[model samples]
Target: MWTAVLLACVGCYLLKLAGMSVPARVLDHPLVERVADLIPVALLAALVAVQVFAAGPGLTVDARAAGLAFAFVALLLRAPFLVVVIGAAAVAAGLRLL
Candidate 1:
C-alpha cells in the first residue's frame, strides 16, 4: 500500500513538472487559450450531470433532476444567483418531502 502511494505521488509530481515545462509560446496559442477557457465549464457541467443523474450502478431522475431543471429555468429568466440557488434547493427539498 505504501509503495503504491509513493509511486502515485512521484507520478503526480512528474506530471506537474511536465505541465510546468510546456513552452510559453505553445501555451499562448489561440486554440490552447480557447480550450483552457472552456475546460472548467465542461468539467463543471460533467460534475453536475454525474451528481444529479447517477445512482450507484444505474441512473436516476428524481428530486435532484427537478432542482437542476428549476435552476435552468431560473437562469434562463435571469434570476439572481442567490435566488436561483435557493430556488433550486427549495424545489428539490419540496419534491423530496412529497
Candidate 2:
C-alpha cells in the first residue's frame, strides 16, 4: 500500500511539474491560449452535468438534489467551505430521512 501511495504521489507530482513547465512560447500561441481558456469552462460544465445528472457508477444525485441546491445557495452567499459541505450533508440527510 505504501509503495502504491508513493508511486501515485510521484506520478501526480510529475504531471504537475509537466503542467507548470510548459514553455511560454508554446502557450503564447493564440490557438493554444484560446483552447486553454475553453478547457476550464468545458471541465466545469462536464463536472456540473455529471454531478447533477449522472446516475450510474455511484454518481447520481438521487435524493440529494435538494441538498445540492442548498449548497449552491450557500456558495452564492459566500459561506465557508466547511459550512457549505456540512449544510449540504445535513440537507441530504434530512431529505433521505423523509
Best by TM-score: 1
Cα deviation at 24, candidate 1, in Å, is 0.5
* Lowest-sum lDDT 10-residue window in model 1: 57-66
lDDT of 1 by residue, 36-88 (tens): 99999999999999999999989989999999999999999999999999999
lDDT of 2 at 12: 100
CA-lDDT, candidates in order: 0.99, 0.87
The parts of candidate 1 lying over 4 Å away from their true place are none
Give the winner by lDDT. 1
What's each prediction's TM-score?
A: 0.94, 0.56
How many steric clashes does model 1 contain?
0
Residue by residue across 1-98, what tens digits does model 2's lDDT show?
Answer: 99999999999999999999999999899999999989999999789678776778666656578877988899999999999999989988988898
TM-score of 2: 0.56
